[model samples]
Target: MTDSFQKRLNFDGNIDEVIERAANNYSLGNLKHSELMTVGLQDYNLHIITNQGEYVIKVFSKLRNVENIRRYVEIIKAALNAGVHHPSMLKDMKGEFIHTDEPSGLSMIVLEYIRGKTFYDMDRAPNSKELKLIAAETVKINKIKFKPSYLFDSWAVPNIHWMYKQVNKFLDDEGKNLAKTALSWYEALPIKLLPTCFVQGDIIKTNVVLGENSQIYIIDFAVSNIYPRVQELAVMSSNLMDNKKAPLLRRVERVKQAYLAAGGELTEVELKSLYNYAVCAVAMEFMGSYHERYVIGETADEISYWMQLGRQGLKEGLGEK
Candidate 1:
């Protein structure tokens, strides 16, 4: 979680009132039950069970710019058109997807509640069949036609260098060395030569929901944007290749093959950069976690899990095992 989100969690304001006002915009009967979700890191997700139906009200944090939020909504529309399975956002009374609360100075959007298990909830990696479906959906997502915006997300793969620079000063000696090596590998890749597309930059376990009938639904488009096309594979492989019985390279090959089977085209440059990008993805995650813990004053225990994953991933990427 980022510093802004931490502050939002501690906010003493009446959030129920905010939820009530936001729900008033939609004719969803009356709010019967509402629960604050603990999964997302960027926004305040309130699960509301109204008299009509269940829905999720996502209140944007202060870190989210309104323009970027609009872009996110647009991306979700594009993803749906491209045959990606995900929750749909509902328009308010004014037929607008986003609603801003004047009293709290917060922007929010309501999406249909998806009843399923996330990979986080399941506590397991996607099985072979699930991985193939996820890859196919990712291909569809990459093929969606959307205009690029100047939205800046620190977690984006293309911004790995910049993120390293920002978080370098806060790392200890071991972390500094690990990040430097990973950055070197990232910099050596022919980044400009690779293809670019709108990617779901953060496709970790929590953002993916496994619905009924073996359907896979992707949620949380907060960090989705234009980037090197291979980044989609890189992000997915790094997070999903958790099978202890398989070699790392073999696991990555499974991801690549599934992607290719789904009609995803990859250039030679993209193939070469895939491993490097995956490694750097882990490194970037580490830096972000470090930034939260050291720079943002979050407890080391809060971020220790990510730090351990980062260190282990960097070693695996560097063939230190």
Candidate 2:
């Protein structure tokens, strides 16, 4: 996707056409499997059936630099090798994730087929026993080197602040001020946030899958960022906001318990920081929802309602003075 335009991805205009080009690239005839397309908040995801299997073809018009995607894939591969329950790398095949310039000079990446439904599609949280396994797998990734400074140019602080300004500004002056305030809060945090551990940043159920073998697999690392352990929890909290089926507060406690049980560390100060970080992260998410609900067009609500919980947590945990 050349990205001469804005947030939209597929350069060819229609997703079907985009998939067609991908199908042609793979020399696939009209695939026996039905075309699968799942649209993320900001990108268009296409799944094309191939002789080998289903392959994910993702497009992003705005970011001409596909290096972010590359780094994430590498990180996932590293995490997988380091024991994160992630998709196995497709060796020697250009199918894991292929970045290419379209005829229009747009950019895209095709990922290997990961066959499984998202955890969100599951009827319930995988049995309590499964939860322990998931926590172990997720934290294993968090324990590794997730320094996103390597992706600063490709995607990092830029995406965060940009959305805060451009997207969140739509809400209100308070929302605008909240965005600015959150950034400063992170900058002036009491504890020194670690940068060594690799973090997925996106921990929503939808991004995770429980494979047929009862194993867990996390895919879609587009939002993956390198940050500290507590910061990782902040991102995870925001992800839970998008989950309306279950009460988020309960899920957080469970996930936190599971994470700690898996040997992840959490100091008292870190817990307090997590409150502020979660609030900041919540405000940031509302800003994103502002864009999704108003600017680009979407029906889901992810802002103020979710923010209210975060704000309350901040007030209670930080002690309103």
Candidate 3:
């Protein structure tokens, strides 16, 4: 009840100015060129070319404090030590992981540009071997140990539930009723069957990079948190297996088997709850995000697309499709 919290930075400003300042901070003599790479609903990523090398500059649109950046830096550093492959965080000229522009209130981070193909770009859905590789890599990420921050505990295990409540407030009567039913179904599941651990919450196919020598690199730790490890599996399965063209449950089983083969553990009950968790998780995401866009008075077209997808996915999960 504190506030409707969304993770994205709703930042809009002069990127040319930001890049200029970042060049100074990172001690890059000159910015050879920079371009707006992709604008997702949540983030604006830029492909930056500097005198030294190519880099990806991320400017969070929403306002996140220095402390939040520090925590992510801590987590990333720990992940590195855990033998998890990821792009290195490029330090600023001042040796800081975070750069804050006082006037713009934008927090930026520079990452070494990684060259690789994501699973999304693959010509076809991943075969069993590739799926196993992804699962094994995920296990390696979950193995990293870190002390939990008290302030962050609120967003970890129950993030989906929290999102559902916030989004429920913005839904029409029918939407609210459907969400209630889904939440009721999800809440009744045996989610507590597995213990909590540090999970890289967003371990979907897109965040993975298959690099030279078949090295697997995981990126984007913005939403990683400590949670029931099965929730991690549930979320990832939901992400990778919800395609209508493919055999959803069967493909998910393969992924689950791959995960287990990689020394990942889960209870049967937890496994059975995957779809319910997935439905709620997906619903929570689109609902909260759509509501945010609505409140901000931004164009609803993109969010509407996701809202439709979420609703359809929920219906399918409920065997209504």
Q: Highest lDDT among the candidates is held by which one?
A: 1
Q: State each model's CA lDDT, in order.
A: 0.79, 0.57, 0.66
Predicted structure 1: lDDT: 0.79
Provide the TM-score for each candidate, comma-separated: 0.92, 0.70, 0.81
Query: Candidate 2 regions off by >4 Å?
Result: 1-7, 13-30, 34-36, 89-107, 122-127, 146-169, 172-196, 241-251, 293-321
- The residue ranges of model 1 lying beyond 4 angstroms of the native Cα positions read 1-6, 9-11, 243-247, 297-302
Best by TM-score: 1
Instruction: Please tell me which model should have the higher lDDT, number 1 or number 3.
Output: 1
State the lDDT of candidate 3 residue by residue for 1-321, as single tens digits: 001112244434555787888878877668998866432334556777888888888776464466766777788888888878888887887788788877677788888877767664552445676677778878887787885463442223355567566566677776776677777876777766757788887765567777766777887777777777766776666555445555345555776788889998776777776656666665554565556556554442445545675666655665632
lDDT of 3 at 19: 80
TM-score of 2: 0.70
Q: Give the 10-residue window scoring lowest on summed lDDT in candidate 2.
A: 312-321
lDDT-wise, the better of 2 and 3 is 3
Candidate 2 lDDT by residue in tens digits, 215-288: 77777666666565665666565454334444445445666787799888887777656656665565555555
